[model samples]
Target: MSNISQLCVILGDQLSADISSLKMANKQECLVLLAELQDEASYVKHHKKKIVLVLSAMRHFAQTLQAQGWQVRYVTLDDPQNTHNFTDEVARAVAEVKVDEVLVTQAGEYRLQQQIDSWQSSLGCTVRCLQDDRFFASIDDFAHWADGRKQLRMEYFYRTMRQKHNILMEAEHPVGGQWNYDHDNRKPPDKSVPIPPPLRFAPDQITSEVISLVASRFADHFGDIDPFFMAVTSEQAEQVLQHFITERLVNFGQYQDAMLTDEPFMFHAHIGFYLNCGLLSPVEAVRQAERAYMEAGAPLNAVEGFIRQILGWREYVRGLYWYHMPDYKSLNFLSATHDLPAFFWNGNTDMHCLSQSIGQTQKYAYAHHIQRLMVIGNFALLTGLSPEQVNEWYLIVYADAYEWVELPNVSGMVLYADGGIMASKPYAAGGSYIDRMSDYCRSCRYKVKLKTGDDACPFNYLYWYFLDKNSELLANNPRMGMMYRTWAKMSDDRKYEIRNSANKFLRNMS
Candidate 1:
């Protein structure tokens, strides 16, 4: 067995059998190491389901490795000897196994990657962090692509990725004459449209045990642990992909940006939990959507928009995260410093949209994109919630959140905290946008049409208030100029009323 030639460290996120660290590992010589670390599970108070998902997937992956004849050393969270962090575990493994080298897939988080990079010299053994090949773009590849670009726009980067990967392409041209179908994909949810609940999986013994462990250990965590139905293995994740393509993909684009009172899923493929965990490959997911379009006659708009998310926005965000992290996480362009309202965690609010979105998040650890952007995120931006607080809340609440993906989306796109890296302007909206796009306003306790009264929806006045208060920082922005002009043209009395209402709400927000 070459006297423990290598110790292969598999992280919770790096569960794929085809992960780079495993590609050259031999069953006879390599020892696979999987540990449930308290440090990771407790970092930022992850959603209960997220913890269960990762631990269950790690256990199943370890079992899969053993079935393939690889020598596996698995450490449960409750292991009496568990030191509760990666570095200590790795140190113990190297000493006990007498391995000459360590092999690991590059960690998704920058902090973890820095630690892995430090291991070789510290451990006195050769440590290799193989490039994570699950992504279509390598870190270096994205860096090279991003070199010297004046503005890092997703649309341009996405187009380049399409050409490089030859995805949805015909010869040298894109399959469609145009690059984006986003305009066509913004239709409000059709109440007449019958939305199927996403496919659910009953927990097996492995997952059931994980649920118990997470529940008892993380009882104070942000989200609910019971009624757990997420796919914890690649096989089950594939079933989710199949369900999305066959049943929901056709209408996914049409209702992609829509939200409703009780409809959280709304034709949105809830497969991000799978995709971010390495259970589903981004390339394979997009290719399936493309195939569905060509073979099953799915609309081009639906297929293109779905493909754009995985191929375009997902890849673009990851690249941006790696390109400007550590610094990126701290950017707060507008100096937003208000504490996040407690209602975010407990969902105790009179606003119907916030109540529904936050309630669903607590229950399922999922919310569709628009609900995230226009509801929770928009409210955060308009109300001047601290970027760090808002960013951490997003990281804490979602099952699919890892720092790389969650940081960019929250700090850049959601809050415009990176100044304009992910967006030209902050996605600041009022109740009108929510009312038009969702059914939440129809039944809201706050009247959507009232702009300044006690019964007025907070969003109605908050939207105008944000524009006026941030005029110094945002007025010169070309995209924001029109809103500034509208604010400029408003009667002084009306403006005073709006600003006063917003200030009153802000002062009382807790």
Candidate 2:
């Protein structure tokens, strides 16, 4: 028996050079496995950029390891002998290589977690799941902090993280004698502000081949297929980080809430894919932003807010996903059952906010945070689409979406499906919210000020209907109760008109 000593499995996303799992890799002793199976890509109608980026990055990472004298067994998507499934592929590799030990970091999805358990029994081998130390705040560490908290707020968690990491701190206290400066970061871009051009890397032959493969194989998927960006390598991802800290981070905290016409990226840092796909480690990314605050005259709000996202919220969501797996994906507090509108796939809509947010996603496989939560997620919630269906749209559409991140954001925080685990209540509202935060509503065909007329913005009607329908589920929420009182004081005639206008808006092709 060959008794292959180690089975080193690399999932598509873990392509980092300094990953802890790669520490024990050896040429003759370990067998490495890489698979591009249908079950993984087809689970959600994957964005075109997502498919190309992952495949190209995986191919590049495998070549680097092989060049360094490691034995790699790469299984391509169209491998004639490929199983096209994760469990079957793991079994096949173990039997062929005669491996007795399986070594890997914990996976990023719940389905994969279950799959690994059964795979172990079939292989009759010892499987060791190492901690995914890429994140500064581990799941164990968060659990320790959440032990006695009555309500888990991101701000509170963010402050704790500031002290634990000693980031932005000054001699046992915060640098500016305060934990946050969010008020300082909300200025709109002005005459002096010119948006910096986004960082673009020239595509190498390796990434070009991956784009060609995705175009050929996944042409049926909805999204723009041409003008694919080359984000497949770690070096390019680091360059994107440097550019943001220097040219954009100062304005990032301010217009982080603003959106403009034809300007898809604005001051947003487009590194979610790189962070999620293992091209950039969380610590270094956070450190770079902090250094900018110390040395490069970046504002406190810009530095602290950017750092909180990575250290506080990103880690919080991942912990929540693991703490309530398999079940978290099924939450539906409002019990919505409507199909997603056809316009979501094609971005063919008169609603300027949705068009910009959803269309930009198809074009770039990216959206800034406010665009996602306020525009798209808000529309889905106000219109009564099922949270599960809404969650699936986000999972399929973004290059950075893994189950661990997507589920909590959609099902918990954005949708309020877990009732209160991720958020206190549904973030339901009208186009007025969009109008205040962005430029999208200004150019929309539907009148943002109208609530019950032919020219009424659909969000006005949907907001009332959503409140009426889910009143029983949400009336007592402390934050929402005041809104309920306001709705109760409205005349019956106006309420009737609003609901009627909402129904007509939903029914009409207009």
Candidate 3:
């Protein structure tokens, strides 16, 4: 322990009261640093709502710390002395406060982590970056698990996580007979009954101020600023979580993969932003779902399915991100190089699925996982859109998106650019899959049944075209051999028609 005061550096995402930085530093001896830098807010032209959510949450967290009698050096985005970066702010704060030591939590993104790792020499202070205890699995633990594994699959990793955490486990065995309920969770979209809305919070004064600031500063950014009902505080986030458990979790599993026109959130918990922003804890979220299964009698399929996302997919992606960074971003296994279309920004495309998903994203800064993976992401994969271009769009558009989570999901899982590191096979599906799972096909300008005619859905032909084009690379995979065999059986004329249709769609996409 240092005799002098410790400067606790709290990043925007590290808003929790139990964060490692806060825990290690005494309130009386620590001066908390929370800055809203232009450099971070404008990184990749972030969605306006995303900027508002982070800034507002940070402001609230700082106030909460102050109520606990902690001295906080809060820097607003408009602070003229901000110098627009964490490096300058940390240097200025240490020099001004004359703190001898600095305590900080590890950053979620690698870029910021690099900057933090260098701060000790630059700031003339003993800097200690404590492990962020937000997640169940630590980076070191994940590394140990990854070692000597030929293929790192989420199912096996998820089972280990379950046992390690003692969650949904019965004395070394899973509570359920199976480790996954994914098969039961893929029911088609149903609109027979009205879908209940997720909980929404009206903007408080702090959030309103943030909205105004983001509106003026990031006017050209994608997504609507109004109707910004995102839960900016931990209390509000918990309310939303409780609401999901009581009203929505029962059906969440079955319809998790289903999509409907203009129905952005169908039995989905819109807690990604909250979870990522530190408003809610992942472990707590999992425990709550498990409790619902036991006490509230929520279906095991729904509860387990929801828990898998937070426990399995979320943790796996973060681990894989750290496991393969600085090199993972550049992996273009399929070598996709096409440009992202303008419709990604404007939602002006004739494809109903794209228009619905993108428009929802523009309005809410949200889309359920299926809309992301199957609709926008699927189209991007089949169309050969540059992985970098696709990755940037996802990073910018979603409120929950951070580089660690978004990059793996986009470059590795969605685009298959990492060559099956994150996914077993390319989640490639034709329009028929969308038709079966969503209602977008009903309203689509293109016919889902048509494979290659003028009014045919681009996904129909593009799905086969993607397979045909990448057969040399993908055919060797055990999971992809059947698709290759099917493609080989197709007549030359039909194959040509599919290829020609895909080419025409790509040409017109520009």
Candidate 4:
């Protein structure tokens, strides 16, 4: 048997050079095992671009590790003898090379964590699950902060994180005398100003090979596989981040919540695709934005809003995901049971908003946050789509989606599936909200101004229908009192018309 002291298993998502498992390992004594598993790629029919990104990044990371003198046993999915799962691969690797222990960073999802937990017994070797230190806060740290809290709100948790990390801080006080500038960041789409497209990298040889592999292997998956230009290396990812800081950060916050037809990137930083995969570090991205602000390169509203996304919302959601797991995924507070519509997959709907958002997703496997939350997710909330269905769709369609981030954002923040754990109320909205935020209504077949009848926007009646249906569960929520009072004030005939319009639309959709 070959003499190896440890077998460090690096997952596709754990591609960072400084991940915990690699840090604790001696380059000479450790055999770094990076595998492209079939089971992982097909877990939920991930978008073609997502598969390409992960596999390509993994291959590039392996090259980097090897160049740094680390011994790596890379497993390609096409290997005839490959076992196609983590447990079997680890077992095979250990049997081939005698190792004293196996080291792995804690998984980002509950399902994978359960499998990781069973490895010690199955492999008959000591298994060390290292905490993922890539984040600003540890899982245990989040747990400690969560204990004894009556309400787990992100704003309070965010303030503490800002203080702990000293991001945008002026000696214990937040910079500009404010902790949040979300109010200044919600301007509707400015049609006059030109939007700078996110920088795209030409597929290098490594990524081109991954693209061909995904195209053939995952031919049936969602999204287009060709024209895949995302950064697959840490250096490339950093370039993308720098591009955003220079060309896009000034306009990012203002148009962040706005949507426009055929404009997918919209001045928003697309680095989440890199950051989620460990090719880019969250803290580094936040620091760069803060630097830009200090240098007067970007406004405080833009800088703070961008920082809040990474340092606040991204970290907050990850904390919430781990703090409440296995049980958290099953929470469906509204009892939403409708199936995800077929149009979500093909973007064949007549609603221009959904068609635009989903069509963009189909081509690029991405949508801006507002397109995700207000347009698509809001429709799911109003129409009572199954949380399971919506969650899977969100996971499948987005390149940045991992269960840790996707679950809380979809089930908690978007669908209100976790009751009030992550959101004060369901992110429900009427057609007018979409109309005000986007130019989609001008082209939609349905009338945004109409509240009832065949041509009325489905969101209009469905919003009230959702509120009326879930009144028993949500009527007492202090934040929802205004909506409830408005519903109560509606004449019985008006309410009937809304319910009828909603039921009719839902039946047709079904």
- Candidate that would win on lDDT: 4
Cα lDDT tens digits, model 4, 266-356, are 9888988888989999989999999999986589999999999998899999999999998999999889999988899999999999999
Q: What is the C-alpha RMSD of each candidate to the true structure, in Å?
A: 1.0, 1.9, 1.4, 1.0
**Superior by lDDT: candidate 1 or candidate 2:** 1
Q: Quote each prediction's TM-score.
A: 0.99, 0.96, 0.98, 0.98
Off by over 4 Å in 4: 1-3
C-alpha-based local distance difference test score of model 3: 0.91
Model 3 spans with C-alpha error above 4 angstroms:
1-4
Span of 10 residues, lowest total lDDT, candidate 1: 1-10
| Candidate 2, 85-130: lDDT as tens digits | 9878888988887776887777878788788767667778888777
List the pairs of residues colliding in candidate 4.
none
Cα lDDT, all candidates: 0.90, 0.83, 0.91, 0.92
lDDT of 2: 0.83
Cα lDDT of model 3 by residue, 1-510, tens digit: 243488999998888989998999988788999999999988799899999999999999999999998888999988878898988899998998889889999999999999998997899889999998999899888899999998989989999999999888889988877888889999997789568887878888999888889999999888898888889888999899999999999999999899988788899999999899899988889999999998888999999999999999999999999999979989999999999999999899899899999999999999999899999999999999999999999999999999999999999889999999988999999999889999888888899999997899899999999998998899999998988999999999999999999988889888
Going through the candidates in the order shown, the clash numbers are 0, 0, 0, 0
